[model samples]
Target: MKQVPLHRLFMVLLVLLASASCREQSRVPSQAEITAISLKRGQLITCGSSDKKFGTVQFDVSCSPEAQTDFNLALSLLHSFEYDEAEKVFAGIIDENPACAMAYWGVAMANFHPLWTPPSEPELKKGVQALRIAQSIKNKSPREADYVAAIAAFYTDWEQADHYTRCGRFEKAMEALHTTYPADKEATIFYALALNAAAKPTDKQFSKQKMAGQLLAALYPNEPNHPGIIHYTIHTYDYPELAALALPAARKYAAVAPGSAHALHMPSHIFTRLGLWEEDIKSNLASVASAQCYAQEAGLKGHWDEELHGMDYLMYAYLQRGDNDRASAQLAYLQGIKKVEPQNFKVAYAFASIPARYVLENKDWQAAAQLKSRPNFPWKEFPWQQAIIHFTRLLGAVHLGNTAAATAEMQALQANHDDLLRQKDTYKASQVAVQLRASEAWIKLQAGHPQEALVLMTQAADMEDSTEKHPVTPAEVLPARELLGDMLLQLKKPQQALEAYEANLKRHPNRFNGLYGAARAAELAADGTKAAYYYQQLLRVAGAAKSVRAEINAAQNFILAHRSPQS
Candidate 1:
């Protein structure tokens, strides 16, 4: 034996170790191996026999045996929008079973929302880094790898892409994920949400949303208590045309996830859309309580943003129902909150909007003109928040017969629009600009330029018609066409005004404003039958309407004085 030196022996050992590593890398897990990872009978935390009935979906995943229970619970929580708890469960799995690639995937996904706001810069970076850790893990199944790859593709150029573009990529990836695993109901559900969210407001046909609705609706039979099924169903059908289709889910969702503030509030999306003021009132009241309770449990002294959000909706319902005393009281409560958590997106929107809603919904132009951001939050930091305040200001100016003031307020709206565009907030940019245009049309009408007003308002209506209303605003805010009808009525074009009112009713059926406007327009146009019918409907919902006593009296007199021949 040649007595080799120590350095030569070390080099030989290194080569041998590298060779063994390559051989191990060649041994990829098979489909059979993947299937073998299903949770054992006793592996899960028993929630009775049917976890599905308990509002939990225990999906099988190819993860470490030690992580099966944690993985299942985390996935169930994630699917229900319980992100905080889900992240905790995911972290436990990641700590105990570092080799479980999907644990990192779970943690990464906990950082992203497919339908809500896109991840902030730091959040996007965190998700990508987590996924990189997942990809570093070996012995992952093909399916698991595919899941990771899909998410990676979505975030591939996230920093370079606009939020819409990134969302489109994520949606496309989710589509691929479901196609690859059609039977994976979780994939199907998540993908449905992506399809619904990917559509621009301009996609009025709701082609993608319709597909989402079908997918979510089909899940109800087997997963009746599935929170995602119920919650996402409300989101899919949260439009005037489809809200009735979602009533069952909306009615059931709050019960299924009673502890979730969002779940408690989500049912009211449909309730509000369909003018179910009583139901909306009950839902948001419950939601406010739930949010406070959740905040207390989480060791927060102040209420969560969710509470403010629910309060805003509650205020809107109160206003819609002519509960002005209650609405004004709620406004005072909001204005007097010792502190507001405006850092949260929900709180910021609600903070800006609740006052705007209180003033604008009541048509109190003078109060709106005098309104200021009471919370003293950095309005510039939240442009959409600032935009809401300015919107009311512009409306107040236009309505009070002050074109110079209205034009000045419109300039503020233009500034917000430009800022939103600079920030890549395409949806709010378009929406705020539409609000500005609506005010501009009103200003033109005030200046005695009726034709110019009509042209401007018609264009505003067309732009607004292209999109569904954003849930953040009071339901009446986005329908510039309603203002078009008001202008048309002002111009004494009763037939045109009636058409506009009828169109508004088609999208926001049975609302007091639309019904009343249509009734008045019909009366002016000499369509006695249609006028009588709309007046009756107006009186039906008039119990909840305010500032319309004169209209209500007129409607009643007309209905009584002109009884139908049959009657």
Candidate 2:
């Protein structure tokens, strides 16, 4: 037979190549589809993949060489809670090598974010689908199958189980996996993460947090660059009692994963816990920029929720330091964002918080009374988060002598608290309860029940002092203990107020209101020396620069009036 013409053969090969390319492209998810799926992954943002080195993770898997390389990258992202990106990478691997069972495992893992909010109905369906696909592939190794089964533990009968219960099941499965493969560093790291995820915010002893910390700290020296190790270490020790221990990890994590917006923001958790305002500011500034960059690259509308989250922290830091202008700019940026992508809990918390915090911290009762939840957002989904607005409004109403408005706002807060209880969010329910008690205390004071007000306020403060604040907040919009001090001052119990303020300062050092309140209380109690010391600290924390806050000026005036005449 005559050989085919060379040009004709080449053209035919080109056509076949084009057909294969079309098939591959069709298999890959479109940008919009990726965005929709990613919204469920908490704070999703695009990041460069040039250096996907998320520390040393050795997950042995049977797949094509190309798929294996991508698998490692995806696994690293999963450990960092970079779920959306990891899911995309894993899906791409499966597209290339359909038999890669672990890639499917990664997709399911991405949807089941143990530490963050529970998966919504859409996310659960997606996760269950991916997990079923992972289970269908029979060529998986015992280890791979075990890994798949561990996630299956979470998805299995999810409708009947609460999020915490499902997470506990997943945690137990991870513990068993760790036992089976004691030498597997991946197993150990994941097990540690599971432990931290299972920790109760109410457990003052921090048993699970410490256990996970011990595991992560053991691996830190060997895997210093590991994003999860460094990130989780900070989280494990984010409490006021344990924050100092996480300083090393907090300092290193940003450098290890400079490209990740979340990595940059995490160090601030420790800083905020320890009241390291300057460091927290730096961390969040970088995070906000990184998040914005990711949004620009993704061509998304407005800022990503990660950016808002960072900006909220940034604003909190600025306000604590009395950098009012900077804080206002952050609020302005937030107001301009007509919408937040994903609109998840992080969005809800930040949106509800930033405005409420601005007015409350400034004691701008008019603004606080007018505080409204961000429109076009799902406030119904987060009743506990929405309570921030009602709580602020109640405070504003009570301060402005609007008892009727205060009572209404207090009722709204109580309803939110009850809603949180019904949802089994005990931590948030407790938080709302504190807000309600404090609001009622103020309302009682306005209604002339001075003794009753003090009792209620003290209970609120004591309740708050019993547990740590959740990581979602930079600090309480208005710490209950500090409010107690304010209530005491209002009741003309200056000495008692001084003691209360000082107590609050010990837990939340250098807060603008804490420092200023203490100074005023000491001044009123005739403790001039203590008053002067707090005023100096206030100046230092609020920065040496001039401030827009009247409280700073009052601090300056008091110090100047009491200054020794010996020039």
Candidate 3:
């Protein structure tokens, strides 16, 4: 060949390198490529690029080729949220492959998402039947077990899912990836995600995040920039202790793939939790900004479904910072989006808090009361919220001089008390309801209806004793008992008030409010000796408040001067 100019040679080399880069980018594979990549990475192999070709490959791998093709098509339809089409596809799969396990799994998965689909008993039974058939065909298939177990789990059948996951029968569901051929990076990433989803949130020692992190770290050690691993490490791991390790990893991943939804959502969730744990609003707001930017990008790319997934963290962060306007604005935006009903509970609860903030800010009980009656009031769905709504409504009614409404709300709240207490898993709801009843009684006392308050308080105390058989944390019962003591004092039942306060003090040794209430009740009972003792105890426990200390000292002086002459 003739000697080429150096510049021309350089241009030729540049073109070659550019062509190689383009080839790599254009190598996006079909579904069949997913399987092929799993078996052979870094190997150049050409397969059919069209969906029809992939369908043929899928048919080859499946035990029942027609059934497998139908099942895969159904799943693809389901992923597109075409429920009617997916159902038809699944039905065809079941018809062709009557023992097709995944056909049932597809139906179940479809029912679980979108939140609008009411999964009937028949559907559940069908799913279970399909799972049984699948199990018979291949007892080693973990995915079949997982699908069956998930249906059980969704119906609050935790015991069933626990059984399968513990027995390792659902290991395929927990696999890092699934492939018709061989697993690839995408498969691994998705597998880790599935595993994380299947992991229990309540496991004290082994959290979902930790399990996810371990899986990701093992699978993608070479790709430190992998979004799946980094997101898991940051969002799932307990913060502060692991934040140093996870934050750097997350930042690196984001730098590499700034547009990755996983990267965006994970950091947002992590920072929001960190803020709540540390009570650091500034850091949380910064994270929210990143989340919003990434979430918008995801939305623009027809990924609105994923965008809706993590907006709750952003909504809550705003709520925590007392930015009700921002919270309300964000909530409105979320509501405007399609398929937001799945997350309605969270968004509704945030809105419910708005009236609470209004109450605190304006002290406008009338406005708060009116807000409670509005449609879509979340308290109607959740017991704790209902209790809070009723309690605040009572306050608002009292402020508005509407005793009848207040009394009616109180009765309604009390009616739900027994049902609330029966809920074992929802302890917070029970506690809040109890506290609200106590508050209602206190309001009666404040209104100068001492006898009414006394009756309500006595009933609350008795209910607390009956409902909670085992000893709970003292903090849990303090609010109920504290209000009861106050009601007793208002009723001029000083002896009973003193007893309640003393009992609470015994449980919570250093509680300043209990000691103070005890001293006040003793004084009301004209027992200078006991009153002085409680005042002295109150002085010791009241760490802050020099003014309170001075007042206690003055009371002690008065008690000493008025000591019973017999003593």
Scored against the true structure, residue 388 in model 2 reaches a CA lDDT of: 92
Candidate that beats the other on TM-score, 2 or 3, i.e. the better one: 2
What TM-scores do the predictions have?
A: 0.87, 0.89, 0.43
lDDT accuracy of residue 266 in candidate 2? 89
- Residue pairs with colliding backbones in model 2 are none
Q: Report the C-alpha lDDT of model 3 over 1-567, residue by residue, as the tens digit.
A: 898999999999999998887765333223342222111112111111112111111211233755666665554334323344456666565555544556655555554432122244554454444444444444225544544554434434423442324223233543522443234443454445455445443343545446666766775566564444555455445333344455565445434333233333445433432333122233333434544453353343322333343444444444333345555676566545543333334334334443444353234567656654335444545554455566667666766777788787777676546555664424444556555666667667667787787777777675554343111111232345665786677567898999998766544443445666788899889887788888776554432223323445655576677767997
Residues 379-481, candidate 1: write the lDDT tens digits: 7867777888887887887778777777887888889899999998888788887787787788878888989989989998888877777766547454677
Q: What lDDT is reached at residue 553 by model 3? A: 60
In candidate 2, position 162 carries an lDDT of 87
Candidate achieving the largest TM-score:
2
Candidate 1 Cα misplacement greater than 4 A, ranges: 2-54, 64-66, 474-478, 542-551, 563-567
Cα RMSD of all models vs. native, in order, equals: 6.3, 8.5, 17.5
Candidate 2 positional error at 263, Å: 0.6
lDDT of 2 by residue, 22-141 (tens): 674334334453334343333334453235345555677987876777787787778777777787778777667766778878888888888778899888978887777677676668
Stretches > 4 Å off in candidate 3:
1-133, 136-235, 238-266, 276-316, 319-366, 376-388, 391-567
